[model samples]
Target chain A: MLPHLQLGAEIEVGPGDDAAVVRLPSPRLVVTTDTLVEGHDFLGHATTARWIGRKAAVQNLADVAAMGAAPLALVVAISAPADTPAAVFEELTIGLTARAEADGASIVGGDLGRAGQLTITVTAMGSLPLDQEPVRRSGALPGDVVAIGAPRLGRSAAGLALVLGERALVRAGEDGRPTIMLRSIQDSSAADLLRWHDAPDPDLSLGWTVGRSARAMMDLSDGLVRDGRRLAAASHVTLDLDRAALAPDVEQLTGLAAELGADPWSWVLHGGEEHAMLACFAPGAVPDGFRPVGQVLAPTAHGPEVLLDGAPIEGAGFDHFG
Target chain B: MLPHLQLGAEIEVGPGDDAAVVRLPSPRLVVTTDTLVEGHDFLGHATTARWIGRKAAVQNLADVAAMGAAPLALVVAISAPADTPAAVFEELTIGLTARAEADGASIVGGDLGRAGQLTITVTAMGSLPLDQEPVRRSGALPGDVVAIGAPRLGRSAAGLALVLGERALVRAGEDGRPTIMLRSIQDSSAADLLRWHDAPDPDLSLGWTVGRSARAMMDLSDGLVRDGRRLAAASHVTLDLDRAALAPDVEQLTGLAAELGADPWSWVLHGGEEHAMLACFAPGAVPDGFRPVGQVLAPTAHGPEVLLDGAPIEGAGFDHFG
Candidate 1:
């Protein structure tokens, strides 16, 4: 199990005993924990263990990245049934180690337990450079320009929609579990969208690069409108999204939207799990990896809000309880 | 939810945005993660959320303590059904904050998700003093003496056995879930044992005290023989247990073991979930909180082993998969 997990040079005592000891270069540490549960966050019966593990690690790494820090290590806790094959856990470890290694990090320690449904919880630890303050969400100014690391959105939500729609055509496997069968989707791009939903490849370095000049930073996990509203509220400002500026993203999903009888605008505004970096920069300070998608304005008497094309947008994104 | 979670002064940015930014007084960080799953790690229907939360936090804190580090912060991830009452989560958070605060630590951040079973995954971060190295399990010398932080053992395992034996007499609640009913036990001490099983009270400061003079240290989560073998294997030494030294522990459980028709000696040797510190110190360097129970010896041709009175002993402890 220790061999399955990756250890970095910074690790003083790798996993074997009670805990892992690591030397962090800086005094400031960024910590975040996230979980992916079977049947809610993902279809455990349909999704591969590797992708599930990768998604769990990437989501937490995205949080550390959003803090504008370099990922140092990850500690994972996984729960599965006793009957689960050993291969599944090994594949999961491979996925977690590979994703952590992608950002020059390591899976230093973890705990494995028994549960009814397979569940994974990953906590990522990151290091901030000496004397550098984390780019917090509360630093956006009235005139700050709102930006996104990439101009792509809604692929994950669309992929989820496709899966749900095809559930009726699912084939039962030998284990009596429903196996994935996308009978209605024929395009490779659509399949790619499904893959994106299963395993999102977030740009881990973009936040650190943009943090150098950005006033505020965050990860777009719950959708632009939802997470953007949080940034605006934290900074005491209103974000006015430029619909025209997001035309490219909507266009990218228009074909799939039409086929699925869904609105591309809705997907662009409220889709979740993109894991892209959402940030606010000073006027003319947008970084290379990001594109301006909106502007930060003074909060109105009504309070901080998220506006689309000068009008208030009303829609909810992914809510765990909902 | 943020109000429910405690934030210490060491936190620069608390839970709200992406992650929590915390400051450590030292460069060395000890990290560990552990999980508790319903119907597997615990009987959720019979346990209170607060006690469950306390047990979850204590187990991880014990790991950090075993490394001879000061508990700094905890990040928790919880998953439960969407229909769960908010009060349950609030209580859980309260228990977590209370336990961490007892050691001058805080619950800096956490995640909540939906799952079929209630599960909690806690990651604790601890800071080592400047210029001090963590007490690892592989540092034991042949002449070192093996000790237990406290003479208490098998209380948790005995408590669990009591609960399992009474499962057949469980009463159904309004929610149709089985509720706890311990009709067979009438003694108050027996009830206290059950409480101990639910919420372990690990001496958080004892490890640091003993670690100052310890050569090897680990948490006694599994039974003595199982975990002792681990320490011996890691240190490349054999541990010769003095059964006479453990007579007091067995005596403490003799009454309860008789009621359960079990051997008190077996409980002392092979019970799990103690959360007590196990360490090795120089022949005359046993700390006030620890009691010598064995002596380390050179590894023989058969390699490192755990022995009872110089004779090889064999037993098994808790295994998540098993």
Candidate 2:
């Protein structure tokens, strides 16, 4: 039997009903959804069900935050094989509830069914604060400062590389077990990187702050270059990111990059899954806790472009279908 | 490229952003989500992508109607194999958008991804009228009259049997083609039954009307016996049906049952996916357009039960994880 979900004060009628009724903070509701497929979104062996649940919740929570709205509630629909462990389901619920609760939201309702693969679909709802307008992706103007909510970038991608590399080594060895290889790379920084990749802690508070002041905003899930290009295209403006401003973020990844024989700058510019907020603010409107990395320019005949150090840089980021 | 979605007045901000901001009708929002998997929810070959899309939308739409709420918007998340034909996606979208539009709701936003099997998760939001409160499942009392939104039942289940039996015969043949078998069963009534199975058109208007006065209400996705039992348990009452009242509905299905060598009474009592509204009304409070089928009684030591013609009937309805 499933555990009883505590009904929050905002929930007039929670789970077990035809639909849940939740109090809305504003007259408008911000809604978004995301689906995570097994093998594609997470590796079963490399991650716990709890972490997978956490990741799934965070994906949508970050989207709500990117809208600059206060999180309200989440409804999830999960499908998995019938033979899946009950403990996995329990752990997943814990992860989902824990993450949503931390973000000031609750799992209001859900549906469970049998499927060939495990899939989690989360729909997040949020409300804007009184007198605040939602920051859109099409509001950027020429001369606006492009800033990032956090300096940490590419840590998740670097951590993924380390984990995948270790898995490959384990498969190549005589014994399939990865105990020896895992011990060989027991560095603290690598552990930190792996943790970041496993479960990202996005600064949702910064998203709220930016929503109040930024003209345009979005979350960086698909890396700087790719998502930056999206922001530029949406706002009909070109973004020119300064190399000097990104050097520190890239330098932080140099150690992991060297260990894996990769480029740190590539990780910083093109790695994804960081869930950092990227926004455009009027000159001098950029707030604290955000670092200026670029400037918006008028659109050209060739359309919007994202530049690095005055030159266009091709970005290789994850695409769900591509 | 995705087609441009027309923005309705209710949609403050549509797709292309982190989330959509939709104007709410009431201070409380009704939310629900449902997922349809490739193998479990439908057979890809047997059902067209468009019908599949419509079924997905209606499932959630009916849930909102059961709450007596006016549907506002829907957000969908779909996952399919990367190599799937683009036409399939287009047709599915056509189905989803068409159905949502028919219900006075728009497909405000969605996410797409690659997966081994095609999957769709829909989250629907609705608003209750200013004076009406949501009818819950636990509000029924003893002596309440049990009513049904429509007198027709079991047509969908009967149709499914005919289709599946035909599919089995087709696979047994040398050429593995079902055209001959399909043509052999070309009764207009049978076609209507199959059509109902393929795409159920539940009268959602009746749902809104019933929500205004029903003491307890739920959409019957599971068979009447099973879902009726659920309603009985939720309200701590036993539902005793008069066999004479259900005779007409069962007689309607007798012809299809004979063609398929099935039991009409069983289908009427145990068939599911009808999405008909089952409600309890205070004695003599049953609204127009709804047929009284049974009456509620106080719970006994045997617990909640659904009786047919003064005797308890066993129902083996479809269970997702059963």
Candidate 3:
């Protein structure tokens, strides 16, 4: 099925308005910003200025939406090298417009200046809609269901792999030669994954909806299990993840795994940029478009474990600190 | 005693809100953005990050504000090298907050990325409170009083003189002395004018108010006489600046001229960053706080001419192109 969740309702003023108007009744607004400079974040890979612009807006908007707040407005500042064409700049403007529209946010006004490299910065805003208190990471209870929005390892890491791997190697892997398997992976799929790596969608409303219902909510930006363990440690709650839900994402990898002689489940259970909403919901209740991948259980001998049926699974998804 | 103009009452939401809400009875919001990169624009010669942050917002906000719209919200994206401390970053945040508060604008949210140098980018939003119509440069009428809200030329450029005097010899005279003295050229009576360049205020509402009764209006940002010529050319009216009111600004400059053996009026007339509001008002009535610095008349011998008393002024103010 297509994305069950549609974006753009909560925005008081959508894209093209001078500025957006959104309400967060609790009297506090959380704000943050980020920028991407060309040749710095990504070099010669499957990338375009448009995707770069889209990613710039999506990543920050995701942060606000992940907080269970309704995203209201976005402002951007772009600095391009003088020789860069007006068209590339124009495309970026349109790219930002698309991402903002996807989540019902608008690009109000920003500044442009000459610089050494292509740089884009975005500021996103969201409103805390409910009278109920915001769901924070510290409140995960002992019997909470640790659920996720979408399957982990969808594109970010997969795309990274394609970018780093040799084209001949990918072809051999998909062709199913056991020792020469890395060669068989399809180059086109790799290309698509690379696009995802550069520009991925962050489910804007999933976290907000989960925050309204769940006891504790946090964004699973760092891989599934790595972030899961961090959440458990932060909340002092024990976490045990179910392995079956991840099977669909990794099933195609089984043959590829045999060629690489590794387990397919490792990528699925641990990969990052899932943009998945993770939360500790009360028993027997799950928010829309969210799948229960784990549970927040009592503190135990296992100690914040990720389990496949009955055994612990190891993972370290895109570590930022290390 | 207090701010001559009481604002923020029309500001539905202020700096701390999720996104500042503004009444935009107009259909479209005109928008633009710019990003300032260290080592490129301000080579350690301008104000600190706090003041840079303020100027960054003001420059863009002034654009729409000049167009006669209400300030709505701002999205700011800042990138600093990894070596930057928590204090500098926090100070920049505070500076942005203060400027937005002063303008009755609010910060929404944005991204923080790693870069080799400091990059500050901002996008601001404005809406025409007067439904459907935004005041543009094309609307000046003949015989309108060319009024202005005091000349600027205070600190932003003055600080530049102080900061970069070693490398950049100020605009000089035959004696080879720096001819343009800032202190002699602005209203020293107003500390607000002194604080202005670093934190210039946009006359957004006044633009709307002026535009309603105004034949045409524009923010005197680039410079006074330079922008005056534009209004004259656009409305097909010649502007004649009264040299008397200007004497208060630079009568002392004439002594500076005697010391340096230069024409002091040239610096006061041409020095830039005077964010005072200048507009063509109806011939008979003038707005409060606005002075009749010039009057609109039929084209003279020089096309769209700006005259100092009976003589044509020698030069236009700063031009980004020039």
Over A148-200, each residue of candidate 2 has an lDDT whose tens digit, in order, gives: 98867888887677766763122212222222234355344776676676678
Ranking by DockQ: 1, 2, 3
TM-score of each: 0.94, 0.93, 0.68
Question: How would you encode candidate 1's per-residue C-alpha lDDT over A1-322 as one tens digit per residue?
Answer: 3347657788998888799888998878889999998788887545677777788888999899998998889999988887988777877777788888998889989888888888999999987876788988999999889999875888888777776666213333444233456666555577667778777887879977656578999998989999998999999999999999999888888888777888878878888888989999999988888989999999977899899877989888765423
Which candidate's DockQ is highest? 1
- List candidate 2 stretches off by more than 4 Å: A1-4, A166-187, A320-322, B1-4, B168-187, B320-322
lDDT of 2 at A243: 90
How many clashes in candidate 2?
0
Q: Give me the candidate number with maximum TM-score.
A: 1
lDDT of 1 by residue, B1-322 (tens): 3346657788988888799888998768899999998788777545677778888999999999999988898999999987888767877787788888887788889898889889999999987876788888899999999999875888887777776766313333444233455666654567667767777787878977656578999998888989998999999999999999999888888887788888888878888888899999999999888989999999978999889998977667655424
lDDT of 2 at A195: 62
Off by over 4 Å in 1: A167-181, A320-322, B167-181, B186-188, B320-322
Worst 10-residue lDDT window, candidate 3 chain B: B1-10
The residue-by-residue lDDT of candidate 3 on A1-322, one tens digit each, is 0011123443333232223333333333444466677666543234566667778777667666655666556667677777887666766776677887878776654556667778877777555533645555657887788777764455666654544454322221222211212345643354455566667776767866655687766665667777777677767777777767667777755554454454567656666655556778888888777778767777668665555555666656664211
Q: Of the candidates shown, which would achieve the greatest lDDT relative to the real structure?
A: 1
DockQ (C-alpha based) per candidate is: 0.79, 0.74, 0.19
Better of 1 and 2 by lDDT: 1
- Candidate 2 docking category? medium
Query: In model 1 chain B, where is the ten-residue run with the lowest total lDDT?
Result: B167-176
For candidate 3, the TM-score is 0.68
